[model samples]
Target: MGKKKHEPPPPTGGLDQNGLEKRLCNCICLCQLVSILSGVALLYLSVIVVSPSKQTLDAEFESTPVVCTTLENMRNSTNCSVLSCGEWCISKGGSTCAIIHAKVRREGSAVSFRDCDPVRATFCSAQEYNQTQQFICSEGEDKTGQCDALDRFMDCKPIKNKADDIKTEMTSLCRNITAIRDCRGTKPDGTQEKEIHVCTRYTCNALNGIYECSTGNCKKLENPTCVDRCSNLDMGNMAVVTPDLFHWGRCRSAFSNGTRIWTDQQKPLSMYCTRIRNVSATEMEAEDCLNGTLMDAPSFRQITNYKQMLGVLERNEEPLFEDQSFLPSEKTVEIFNRTKVMINVLGCVNTLRKECTTWLAHKGRDGSEGMHPAVYPCFITPHATNYVITDYDRQATVSQLVMASAVPSCLLLFSCFCLCLCGKTVGVNEFGLFFCKPCHKQDGDGGKEPAKLRAP
Candidate 1:
């Protein structure tokens, strides 16, 4: 009988096979569920990615003129418009083809402009010509009798009556206002760009197909909106339709030597947006936007902080902290500093927002409530303030974020909820509590002993 005995019958072969099958089924179902959830999240992200809607278009004008002395042979061009002033500096409509404020090449054979230098660089490219540019006559050439200095240095005119200070309080205000506007961008586009403006808004009215760059024909949108507020590319902030400092291309000096005029706007490693080691004062060379940003800062141009000044200006007319002269008084400095702080935090949710949107038929609930839309921003047009931040508004990045972040989060939560209802939590091994059976898990007798195995 012992010789005839075979190996002990396998214990419950059917039960082992059934358990394995159940685990495999659970894994497959979980995978399918995760895949479906990911798809849904992606679809949602796509829906929000849309072309920016048309924003309000209000005209901005700074009629007060600055009394700048004209350069010899430098004359205003018909094409001197905000859309074309940056380009008009180099055009050849006789010697007068250059912008009114453009310098003349005294040494060159042609009646050519002196490469815009300090004058046209900002009008042309802000990153290339930041805030260091200024309109001053050469110390030797600015004399009362030199190169129509009478007209060139209108701001330097003296009064015979009284103490020879400001002509009048009102005149002083006009001059100061003009000086402030000039410190930033001048004659920026709503009216005419080629024409040098003393107190013009340093902006490009950020509507698509509206503003164009002087170099590379780059439209304003190439620079994305960084501030949650306005988008003007003047010298104050890096926002769109706004711009600012010691960066190259804005200007090489208070005067021009010709070679520093034209620069590429689609900034590359070799692009001349900064001074090369601060050498070649005539070349507008900068290799990085961040470097340029630091160099042009008003509060601390010498320090290189990674953060940029974005949406800091509601009115491009504000004085810059970098130039103490622009901030004539302590009160002014305090006011501007407070303004920058507030706008940086609240965006264009204040006066600038109202002024920017009042003309644009912003008929939202806020508009009806006698206020600009606070829930959404007013200056949040398509034009962004920075190039790096533009990617977030892109469709591809949004989709990836949803898939990468949402799926794992959902799975973790699902697993935790699942554990809360479990009856059997197998553990005390290598992988503790890896799997478990729910309290209501189905059994042939529903937790009761099977009739066949029950004690009589």
Candidate 2:
């Protein structure tokens, strides 16, 4: 018999070549369709995942009350009075009432009593009194026995109301001294002294050639020369005076160096006794004093304004909602007209310093617009578009879009590879691609061989 033709064992699974090819083509078509559909679905899902929706939200804002309280209550108050006074005293080259008040408060009983407190005649001496009497009698128009008698009488009669008498006598004496002088013939510094009479009031100290009594009473001198032995004029402490005072105010320095410098040349030194309006428990509002005019505490309305930017929306105004289908025509107008909104004042400084201000408002869920107590740096206007622009578009970044597209692209490439191998002599059945090498029986030759490919 003719050797049997070695036709490739009947196409696996009892399927004819035509039948197997048909089944493989059908599988490739199904896989290609699945890949295309999956890719399209993935692309659609990616767009939905990254695209940001645009909507106009009706934003309503309110503000908390600006409760006035001391810095001690605010938990930031400091004893800067010492530095404040020392700087002022140094600036004018003299001491002031504010300085004396500060000294007395800080140093307690250690501070020498001026004639302001004559009950404590700690520095008064008979020798000083005799010299004062002699100088007064000599300077008067009547240098006769009458002036000496008057001086004697004043010295003896001052016990009844010592404080009253001292104030009266000191005021008279200070007014008479056209120029400052050393009470003793020679200067206290042991130098030859000329014709100036030392004046004593609350305390004994040499006065400047030109001096004026500060407003309250003669108890404190406005512009007296820095001659008191007890005056602790420390340059180090005074050097930090401006920063300390600014710190007391809690002001953010507009200077490039982030500090406020105090110099004689700078107008309106930072140590001036300025007032803040709309002061709250945590915040202090600074105000400018014009022509030395003292400003009164801010009114409630002004305080409210300082804390918030209030506005009234007119009826029929453009609706905050981009899609108003859910809102009634009349309701929209009513809500718009009734709703009130306010933005917080960024800086605590007065209205004159607008450059430091921010347009951002503190927004809260409830109507009560309370905020945590913290200082915020000024916002960059150019970068802060979300704050000012009510209606703006937001979109996903380029990187997100790329990632969304890449995942589906990889899936499509994998599916295409499977499609290309569909009709080969490999396992491709209704259950899908299966490896047959593990399940196949080994031939007598000891070589592992694949089982016949199954046809769907």
Candidate 3:
């Protein structure tokens, strides 16, 4: 007989097609749940965890304390830090009071009382205690005699003559030589020591009886000889030197009734003028003018009656200098023009000593004609009138708008994509339950055959 063929083992725990389908359905549902949970976690990290961490960092930065050590640093510190340091200094009296006293001696009345607070008077009085130290450290000590001689030189006014300019030059040279000799101390061999002198420039207006000099290398005058008179004889009507465009010489024009009026040769005009008039008990109208039109208005006043209007000069009891004729020499005019062009090019408006706005109003029958606009409609408007958006505000608004729209939309799209990929379902019943029932197949011996699974 032939060897019996090995019979194939029957499949264990056989499942039908329906059971395979149910298993596949369960697997898909599990995968979908996992994907949804993963998406939610991603969203939490993106929106809640990461974003809140940045916010927390910003909050920490804002809450951080400002630290200042030295007095100079304390002075330049933030308001909160300054207050804290001041309080600390106040509590730590003795040494801090000495320090405050030193500062008061150096800065004089310019020192801020806020830093010393309740002890300002004590700090000020400390100067008396330290007077000997001030004298010991003074720059004026070694040069006292020379400075007095220089002061005498400044006082001596020679008789006005043809050789006066030459005499003045010699006097300046002698004073400068004396200043340099005095600033340098004598060595062991009687030779002058080579030490640098630190000099500060000050306007004549700032100078009082005694020249307040800072302690450094040594003290020296910028101009060794003071100006007893104007240097140039050509400076006619301009007795006082002024840093301005139309300074007692250069002509300025104004508009009246659609006509440009030039000032007299003796008196220079102002560029702009302001006039005020009473409209009611509670209200008044003001008008301002440039060379041509009223600055506040779009249209020019074609029909202005100067006679009917009472000028500000009449209301105020200020006297108008009617007898004076302010005629400047040709040299003075040239200097004024040159200085004006230079300052204008450099944009040094703050340095101008006499601006057109500073001109006083004068209305008289005779010689005060070109002083300032009298009955002219001139108004003083507020410097800044329009609303403006700053760079910081604009940037903040843009950032807020972008965050409001972009963040939510991005999260929503990510969630939808995750659901589409992992949670696709095909069959469902009327009761909203997923249909996946197992079905069995009969074999020739009345036994069930294993079901082959299909991918969903």
Candidate 4:
């Protein structure tokens, strides 16, 4: 019976093989579908899923670009500007990623960003400020905590009409003006440089070509509308005209040496030295008394701070005019005669008439002489009051005469106009108007030459 049962099982072996083949095919299809579904899930997550904390911010600025992985890092990054994180993404490998991007547009030497989270401000190069080099942006600090707290500061303020608020805003803006009072830069030499912020509209002045600090405003440095008489170098707030000063120095030297005489128009005429005194002996003594006496006597030499010296003159109590006398009265007489002769020779009669008529209209003859008013004796001009002749030469040499007459012909009218100005007492005749004289009365004869008339 056991032999017969085994024989029946052997007969069904072919069906068992067919059943095994069907099961193998179903397993391969299931594996393929599972692989495709896994890929689909990954792609879906890539498009929508993102981490909240991990972010990157990018800014294109003149200074430096910034990239940060989180908003907290962004706030700490020195190169970060006025921006915040907006969106983020997670990588397929489950890596968290964040990004922020911004661009700055400005044309200036330096630009500063305000309201930035981590990196607050950056400076740019300008024509004047930091002339030596441009500032570069660099890493600043670490901001780890307070990530959610910063969002509270991000709400945009509603725009409002600013015409009236502008006035108040101006005051509010300037409220911090004096708050940064200790902004002065220190030099290596232990001196402090003046501190001024050049970024403002109220203080800007076009008269200044560059930015400067006004009392409370930023002002522009102005170019000279008139001639530029000085350099950009600082003279401690008092500008010095070098060329003008140099010319004055030359004139002063010539004047003191008694070897040069210049016209009112700065024309060198003749070399003549005439002795000058300090008004009176007692005048010098009074000066000596007020200033507690001098180391030496007061001479014709120019004094430093003459205005201060004049103040001393006002308070002087001692007699300074006593015993004061003119040197060589005969020389004075000869000069007077020569002047009279020149008047007659030059035929200034008509000019004199016009000037006298004008003068009488302006200043009536109460005690003043009409045609020839005496202002310190030697001065003879229409507006010669308070004027004095500093020097006089008997005869000018030919060389001196040429130099005196060599001024540009174009300036003749300008010189005349300047003389007619209110503060000017010297007239055109002093610089012009040649005198023709009788042969005996000419400069070469009988006139005693002063020291100033000597050749240099």
lDDT of 3: 0.24
TM-score of 1: 0.19
Q: Cα deviation in Å at residue 101, candidate 2?
A: 52
Off by over 4 Å in 1: 1-279, 286-396, 403-410, 413-421, 424-456
Candidate 4 residue 315 Cα shift, in angstroms, is 2.7
The stretch of ten residues in a row with the least summed lDDT in candidate 1 is 102-111
Per-residue lDDT value at 54 in model 3:
43
Candidate 1 local lDDT, 1-456, one digit each (tens): 133333322222222334644574466457557656755654543332211110111111112211111211112435522211121112323222322221111111111112233321222221211222222211122221111111111122221222123233211101111111222122334333342222211111111211222221212222221221112323411211112222322431221223322122311110112112232433322221111112224442322221223212222234322342321222222211110001111112212233323312221122121111212111112233110000012234345455655665677566545544332432122222233333223233445533333223
Off by over 4 Å in 3: 1-194, 197-223, 226-248, 252-267, 271-456
- Report the number of clashing residue pairs per model: 42, 6, 7, 26
TM-score of each: 0.19, 0.23, 0.21, 0.15
Query: Each prediction's Cα lDDT score?
Result: 0.24, 0.26, 0.24, 0.21
Displacement of residue 390 (Cα, Å) in model 2 is 11
lDDT of 2 at 205: 25
* Model 1: how far residue 220 lies from native, Å: 42
